[model samples]
Target chain A: MIDKRVGDPAQAVADVKDGDTVLIGGFGEAGSPIELIHALIDQGARDLVVASNNTGNGQVGLAALIAAGRVRKMICSYPRSSNSRVFPELYRKGQIELELVPQGTLAERIRAGGAGVPAFFTPSSVGTVLAEGKEVREFEGRPYVMERWLRADFALVKAELGDRLGNLTYNKTARNFGPIMCMAARTAIVQVSRIVEPGGIDPEVVVTPGVFVKRIVEVANAAHESVLVAQGVTYP
Target chain B: MTAELIHAGLTRDEMARRAARDIPDGAYVNLGIGIPELVAAHIPPGREVIYHTENGVMGFGPPPPEGEEDPELINAGKKPITLLPGASFFHHADSFAMIRGGHIDFCILGAMQVARNGDLANWSTGAPGAIPAVGGAMDLVAGAGRIVVITEHCAKDGSPKLVDACTYPLTGRGVVARVFTDLAVVDVTSEGFVLREIAPGVDLDTVRRLTGAPLLAAAGIKTIEP
Candidate 1:
């Protein structure tokens, strides 16, 4: 009888305010909480700092939010894609800021946040320009760059299926950052394809327990990026 | 010996095939973008090399069918890919843990420049508007059991890529194990760049001159079949 379902996607993100840092889960088109992102875009939150992988592909997801001038900054690995032009255009004009992190380092930082670790040493950026000005220490004769945790105010994620209590399951590689983001954020809102009773999802199959999830919004026929690729369109 | 024209060296695909030959059977390998990605195509048939894409895909298959492209199944590069039998996906953190934990056996990467002491620099040239995207190159080099660099012998202006020391930002220090270039296969050892195999039609002297560092030919140097 436990249900975390909100009235709708907009309602799911109603608490977001300007200048709040939000973490979005995905790897390009996979696992992006598009409906929730669209809700935030429509909700008119401005000057928001968003952290994600690849800053969304084209105008299909987070790029649309960026196009609306809602995002003030982005912390991600790769922000360039063949179909994505909004970010590059905005970035070049000095309209938006970027804090680029190597993908593995980014993931570890978020994991560290969720695990309550203050900071961790990583070799990913040890000798690269990204390592400049950071604390560096040698571990067993190998230098490791010090990386801090990246906790977020809110985390928006997408999943293939979820129960009323918020136990989530994912489809294919779309599961990329969903679970970790759920743990790293103060409040985790999920957009899912289906909502079932508690027993609907197999106990062994739940990748993210409901404890980390705060709200669930059902989104049917969600616009995944495959739809864009099928049209043979390259740019936004 | 019949002397030939200056070496045209091997093609990119040929360089990729040479890099592929270095992967051991049944090893879990992560291929970096560009030259390293081509290694997947040249992996010998029946070889059990499990390809792991940093975006959370493991046990990779060939590219997806023309019209059957699924965005959900794309690799870290955002390109459509097919999943081999038994392929599975996990959270991004878990994927990286596998990488940073040294679970991946081998990783093939493309280099902008390599120092004589096995230092690697490929992520950024510090060029304006160059994207500066360093997806997972550093993590692989820092974590994988072995790192192989595959690239052309020289820059577009014909400057040597394998140098006495790298001027570009280092992606890793003393990490590269092998270098497969258009002209030869070289090993990065304590003694510096040692020429292992010269491309067909390439003389040992040309290989030595083209290499920015000191090149020592192995006692029994083999010819790289084009």
Candidate 2:
């Protein structure tokens, strides 16, 4: 019985400590683990370094966490969102730090972190301002900038389905960073829409294997950030 | 000014249609957010193009009908999309691997500035206090096999977009293969901005005047039919 199910979002995120590098999975509101993020907010961990695609939209999820001053830094490709003002304001006043990597490079760095690679060379930011202060080397007559791997102390992810064994699947584009972040973290806590039996999911379609996942909390009906933002909902 | 005079040369959609014609059948294409996204609707009939969105979908279909939008099913621009028959989802690493690995055929982008040397500066203006958001622009420019930019001939303030050198931050150095502007179809060659086609009713002199860099007419320059 390799059951990794947790009772609630609070319990799932209870162990996150201050100064941990957390990978919050989502490309905007799509795959955001809202309940878990809100729970982490209530749990009151401070000075977190979060890595995600965007800062967040409106005043919920990642934005709320940032508003709560729980995040000290953001490592992302794009920090601005259509409805996000939290990151920009904080960034302007120098309250938060930012490390902007190109989207593909960010993905590859996380993949490299999970795959046990220390660093890799890429042409994504070569000769651009983003490539400044980095090591540049040419291979086969083409220049490439070296980017280091990105690992997190914990990864909070949202998934479509999960079994007691922790194997998971995701919904559409929401699957963007979930699978990779799971592998790149010391502990991957997932909030799934449904929890099933061990044999419920097809083995071939499991996006995040049970090995990378530590805890699974069923969020049955997850709230979307767009609807929340539209309703002017602000998290605690 | 009459409407005819105010709306001169190819329209934005027409520019996209013209750019769409260059995409070969069965090619894997990535469309940047704005004007370049229009290229898909105008892709020639009978061509089976596989669309790739960097957010982790391949063979993406048209936008879902109104009211059926799924927030999770989206394109690289974060707009809702449908899954085409051959659609498959993968993680971010594999998605970018298809790109940086040189597996994608074409990537069409919108540009803020394009230098004669093919340098692009679409990501930022380098303005102080402006929060820069690069997204996948740099990756697409660096990895896509053929980088074609579709943009207006001039900026809103009437400054030339096709300039001698990009004044803003660079997305890539000498990466643009071709450019489709409202006024003309241009190619970025070692020689300079070579005009391949001229929009009907627009003269070469107007293009040369608007272009910040010198423009060269290619041999047998044709009138844009779209």
Candidate 3:
């Protein structure tokens, strides 16, 4: 059951302890839980093991932790570009540990963890470096690679809208890593722009149900500044 | 009055060269998997185009030499890739910021189908045996400044992949800017789908017969040279 209460992002994030594994939701900057991120930064959480689709942007997302010397290790599919300079410098100096997973397999591993599946076989990384040191098996005349499940101590997510029940609806690209991480963590904390009463949202629109979410905190707008920066920029 | 050439049989390398020609200098581009991957090999020497991979490297170079593969440096497919000089690495979040935030100039993607209205349905074919993974195609299509589709003219079953509308799940609605196929170069325009260039040695009527959708001829449609 979801505990719906008005709370501070900083205080809620203070629940995280040092050396805990945290799953951060975002496909880049789209669905990042900035409020919680700021809260964690303000609290100066340390020695974290973060699992996420990608490292957050340098100034804003998970990079903030890296910048603040909090995160000790990161398990992610991609970890370059936003904090390029800081990442390499940290790795070269042995300040942080990094593990890279194939994009598809990483997503699936998180999904498998959330679904209560211990492991799954996929051909995505078969016969490649991604398969190195991983358990391999042949299924139906083709080789399949094994990926272990990933479950974090805390899952941080952002939603466009939510309810007191903790149901979530993500907008556009924000939907990428939010729902999967909600299931792949011991405790899920969500920051939403709007929170309504229970049953206010249609079941079909609830991508992450309250059963998967443990807490919901409401904010006014999550992407307002990022949207302002993104306006008029043409992507190819 | 002579018959116009449509799509012609060409080697994958030749097709890559044809696609690379359309890219402008210094454009930030994402090359999708399969034949589209070959485009990187054909980038003209000294022309700078930053390659952004969803797995979080920018200013990426070509594949690394044998035995030099870095386990830490990989593309979205998990294949090891080399980083060029001045290359930067960052969190996966920032790489996607480049994509969803519109920092990328072009996204050259492989497609299963491209509709006349420019809808792209590339991630899933809805085939019973095909593995369905949408990946980053939706974000790439919706966020890129220009969407360039690279694929064969038809599927193995002989069905035209470019059509009046897509039957498969859409990666993005009406986001395709242009399509580069083995046969021709087609532009998705508000006026409709225009056949701007045909493959060498192929005729217009042959392309017309192969296409399932209505074909509009751009004013200066001509044969694309290798």
**Steric clashes per prediction:** 0, 0, 22
Model 2 clash pairs are none
Worst 10 residues of 1 chain A by lDDT: A227-236
Report the poorest 10 consecutive residues by lDDT, candidate 2 chain A.
A73-82
Ten residues in a row with the worst lDDT in model 2 chain B?
B1-10
Question: What is the C-alpha local distance difference test score of each model?
Answer: 0.86, 0.93, 0.74
- Candidate 1's residue-wise lDDT over B1-226, tens digit each? 1111345688899999888888889999998888888988897787889999998988988897798888788887778899888998888888988898999999988899999899999877877766667778888888989999999888876778999999887888899999999899999999999999988877888888778999988899999875
* C-alpha TM-score for every candidate: 0.94, 0.98, 0.55
Instruction: Give the per-residue lDDT digits (tens) of candidate 3, residues B1-226.
Output: 2212334555677778888988889998898988888998888888889898875667888888998865445666546678788876543434556775689898888888889998888765557533234456665764678889888888766788889989986766678888887778888988768899988887778777777798888888788877
The per-candidate TM-score of the B chain, in the order shown, comes to 0.94, 0.97, 0.92
lDDT for residue A65 in candidate 2, whole number 0-100: 98
Is model 2 an incorrect, acceptable, medium or high docking prediction? high
Candidate 3 Cα outliers beyond 4 Å, as residue runs: A223-236, B1-226
Error of 1 at A234 (Å): 13
Which parts of model 2 have CA positions greater than 4 angstroms off?
Answer: B1-7
Tell me, by lDDT, which candidate is best: 2
lDDT of 2 at B17: 96
Candidate 1 lDDT at A11 equals 97
Docking class of 3: incorrect
In model 1, which regions exceed 4 Å deviation?
Answer: A226-236, B1-6
